[model samples]
Target chain A: MSQGDGIYPDDLKYTKEHEWLAVHGSIGTVGITHYAQSELGDIVYVEVPAAGAPVVGGEEFGTVESVKAVSEIFAPVSGEILEVNPALAAHPETINRDPYGDGWLLKIRLAEPKEIDALMSAAEYRKYIEEEAN
Target chain B: MPPAAGPLKTTPLVRLFRDMGARLVDFAGWELPVQFSSVIEEHLAVRGAAGLFDVSHMGEIEIRGRAALELVQKVTCNDASRLGPGQAQYTVLTTESGTYVDDILVYRRGENEFLLVVNASNTDKDFAWIASWARGDVEVVNASARWAQLALQGPKAVTILQGLLGGPLDSLRPFRFLETEVNGTRSIVSRTGYTGEDGFEIYLPPQAAADLYQALLRAGGPHGLRPCGLGARDTLRLEARMLLYGNDVDETTTVLEAGLDGIVRPAKGPFIGSDSLKREKERGPARRLMGFEMIDPGVPRHGYPIRVGGEASGAVTSGTVGPSLKKSIGLAYFPARAALPGTRFAVNIRGRDALAIIVPTPFYRRPH
Candidate 1:
């Protein structure tokens, strides 16, 4: 119930692990949802795989550490890493501030474009998280 | 993330903070707020102005009757006989091996009355341990359920709390307490805190907690007081190099090894762990706790292995990127030979070894 808690851009597809993917043709930008960042508290550091590394769907490719706990960030769909967020090394709290925009973790080249169809839409994700709360 | 339901214990201020959008987490077994707006913001607020914290989860045990001081002197490692009425001392409940049962605060209420404040998670264990040593007319009671505690910490703490006092608090020095009324409620106000700051810890009845909490916030708003949670508490205490019972010291860590030899009073005569601590003192502790700051980019975390001068050393006990100092600082146990300042270390962060160096502790101290 804090800032950016209710935001879920309609253009982005969501994963059950709390990641959001914004697909643009064959390229997609990935970031954790606002709920994930808020639940993790104050994020101090982030570690992501370097560009050109291939990642499998539903597997951990990076870590997000807050003051008290560490969480794994998973890939929503199998893809090759195109770029990792350089800003995160110095300012990881951007995830808590503007998660949907500047906080994006990585840019990936999609292996299967059809994978987006299987993911949840913004409204569907909102419903999914509501059920998750109970 | 949602309302904490089920078996987790909650403090009296849960509902008030939950309504304020504070993020709650499971600490030990209690459902408590971790942060209000953010940990860094709350931490900075405490350093610049003041912060109010709900510490009602801390356990309180009261001992009364003719043999109260005798029973206290038997179980704790400090010289409690030195305390006059209305004074408090930081001491440890020592195990037979000269290690900690729990680090606690002993308050001498009167000649035959004392109050021991212990860690929340160790309440039941401490009570049972104290009862086993009771061999006289003294009565030991777990008064945790009867009291609610609040900590007002930082430079502005006195200015904010002085408004509610019926009389001036000039007589209340550090580590001193007085039975008084705050904002019309009878309370015990102590000039002590875990954070290295000018603060007061107020203890009152359970039901009166919420009202005083709101009153303090209202009175403290203009003075720049923020409602802080456990996250800020941990960060603040770490910056001050205060030991966390479960993290920095425990049943396996001796007081001497933790660099607390000053608190050990051998001349007070035989107590629990006295004989073993005496022998350890003669031989010197094999390992010692040292404070360090990271020279590399990674943050040191609890239980992470460390290497000193190319050999495996102990793990980190407590660590955080200090909000006040803005540096990654931590405490770890190392071989006594390598425990000095300027010694280099490599802290294992996940699969990578990050560079660290021993530094003088109290990474952040308040400017006078």
Candidate 2:
């Protein structure tokens, strides 16, 4: 289900740090939330782990750098990286343009299925950001 | 998060910032816009057309008395005697150890009157430091509250400002300023800016700030002037290689090491840090600030370690992907021998070493 204006999709699970997980059976596509990309003015460069790398929940897998500061991107769930987005290296601004779709950073095979249940739903994530704004 | 220690100050144009949909953040105890549209868009607008900035947050210290020049010369590293009426000079307040207290601009308002503009973050400290050296007939007043500053920068800056003034702005040479009226408000217009592009900085009364800002926006709208914020300001200055006080230089770094030798004149005779600076010049600075561009994928960031030949070398002070240059550029301190242009080093970015090469600064110079 698509959220209004496609900012946050209902099918995605979110982490407190703003990473979104789109579960597709056992494989999940992970990327930063729209809030995350908006907070980082311009995405000049992104460093992602190569395919086949192991990523654990709550561990930093890469960094998203803007012109002003660098932000660490944490893995939402423990998994093995199946593929990393090749478009990010050349056009990091894609994260700011289409954070939910083409901006997906990686596709991973879940190592902890139970971790997905603990993630926040779309409605809960919206409330989290609303409280954060206040 | 806990609230700030003291109440945050707001500029006269704070309302205007909010009206323009600006994203405001707490910068050095002041509520200022970090960006209006986007950093890259605003930055490019300054490079291609023009951009207006509210620089009222910058501190203004007024020194007035017969001994004003003497007090200024004593506290700053540059020779203030060379400044005639209506001229400005980039100078630095140095400590006894030949380290930076703050980098400032000295504007000669009159023969015995001077206005010192300092970084917003170090306003209190700089005022206190300058006041400590005030003696004789001079009086130091923190006049920041009375004045507001606006910087209109880019290629079309002159055209936009000249339209507002309805005067011959081309006659104003670099580093020169004129006391004139702009849109019925008295102003100090100077042909100076931190950005490497041609621009004008207008200093006027706080009460007249909002009106003049609105007038400029209306006039400059057709000329493609965007309202810029601190985000674009930082990137623009970085692309120009202008040093940001806390980021590029601090009390631990000397003028010589920061590559600002042009402003430090030892021949001018006794001044604060002159002796230590002379000694350092004779012995040669151990570390020097150099500009570099990343050859690898990763972007170097502040406090990132620099390694040369697998040995720890130095640390990056400022780093960014230059919007104009479209490359990752930064400034770092390196051993004197490794500070030359074309020298190669590795920046430790997130546990990985990224290759970078030293390059001559002012990374983006405007084509005349």
Candidate 3:
């Protein structure tokens, strides 16, 4: 669990790319950090992977646009998307306003339990965000 | 007049932007402050109140001699003959194939003197091109270093200037200029701006620029004037649906492609690109520029592919989600049929599909 910087949840594991994953039973919930949303600005558009789409670890899964720039969002773990953020369609700026809550991106059915072990803990993710800011 | 041969420099305004905690970005090889405040706040200040801008990065070149207009008219895509003394005209210089070299706003100081305000990155190239095609027995002196520009833009701009000028500025109207005394120094004030707001573009000596900016800040600060950066100017212009040179039009983009044929007036004179433009106008542009909005949550951007009926038709040249309209707006070249407002299409942004609708250019309008 990571919490040194950014809005890292102690209950979740994270990728260096800034994705946080929360495991519950056989599923994992995923979303970018508050730091990511702050850096991206008011999200204007989102390209979400369709439900049931298989996502490979270290692969791009979606894109987000703010005012003038676009950033690609990557999948943190190999899994199948069970649900995508539907609220983001009309209110993309929610990512900036409430990135960790209403801005949650997707829920995926976990492909491997060992992948979670490789992810960062809350304290580690916080330090990672701080270094990136510099 | 050669390719920019030195490292790019930042203006004092960059420091000001940094002090205001603006997000700095690389623009034209220069580190420019994108937005000091929120893009919406600064943009609305220009549209509603007054917004001050640091436009010192723009290039200025002086053309002096009797052949000034002669050379200028041939070099640009506008009728310079109508530009009397103390008047300005917006025009574009094109290549032999009719693609844009750069867009400029030319100020005619007198019958034999002119000034061309050009895009910063293209300054050297524009100077070189104008020098090589010198039809005028005149001196083309680059004066970008000795001068600076600050734009005070809003509905209240004239009132603020009137207070500073100590007299009515009657001689200056839209596109007109006046050489007046400001702070004991001669300054040129023009009734023009990039934002759709009524405003003034002030030109003064570089040393005097900082003082004048301070005075303007102190005077207008209480009246809701904010020191806006390029970020606000961009969003404001985008709201007005004004075309940005490098974004909406570039070296490979033509007058017709950008829907600027009305300004071309092919019969103006025999000039470079006249033949090509005349033919292109007759043949119709291969693609037409369009304004679009995303129906889905996907912001299309420059270089993003525009698809119609699942076929690649064109690519975006400029794109953004407007702060005012709260919609994703983009400028792209597409088939004439796709240019029609209300036509539906898809934008492929980083391998993701965004449903797009062809909307009219300019997503925002001031109520008349």
Task: For residues B101-136, write the lDDT of model 1, one tens digit per residue.
Answer: 999999999999999999998998899999899887
DockQ of each: 0.73, 0.78, 0.44
Provide candidate 1's TM-score on chain A.
Answer: 0.94
What lDDT is reached at residue B308 by model 2? 71
Compute the DockQ of candidate 2.
0.78
Ranking by lDDT: 1, 2, 3
lDDT of 3 by residue, A3-33 (tens): 3444667788888887778889889888888
Task: Write candidate 3's Cα lDDT for B1-368 as tens digits.
Answer: 23344575776566556666778876787777777655667877877889898888889989888788778877888788888899998888888888899988999999899999999988888999988877748888889888788899998788777777855765568999888876556788999899887889988887788777778888888789988877678877876778888788988889889888867856778777889999998888988888888887656677888888788987887777677677678888888766788889888867677898888866777665
Q: For model 2, how does the per-residue alpha-carbon lDDT over B1-368 read when each residue is reduced to its tens digit?
A: 13247888999999988887899989888899999879999999999999999999999999999999989999899888999999999999999988989999999999999999999888888999999999999999999999899999998988888877856999999999999999888899999998888999999999999999988888889999999999999889988999998888999999999998889987888888999999999999999999999999877778999997678987899898999999999999999988899999999987788899999987988999
* TM-score for chain A as predicted in candidate 3: 0.90
Give the lowest summed-lDDT range of ten residues in model 1 chain B.
Answer: B1-10
Candidate 2 per-residue lDDT, tens place, A1-134, comes to: 12355577899999999999999889999999999988887999988879999999988988998887789999999999999999998899999999988998999999999999989999899889888877
Give the poorly placed runs of model 3, Cα more than 4 Å off: A1-13, A22-28, A50-57, A78-86, A108-114, B1-7, B159-162, B169-172, B181-185, B308-311, B336-339, B352-355
Residue-level lDDT tens digits of model 1 in A23-100: 888898999998798788889989888999998878898899888788999998889999998999989999999999
Error of 2 at A94 (Å): 0.6
Docking class of 3: acceptable
Model 1: DockQ against the native?
0.73
TM-score of each: 0.95, 0.95, 0.87
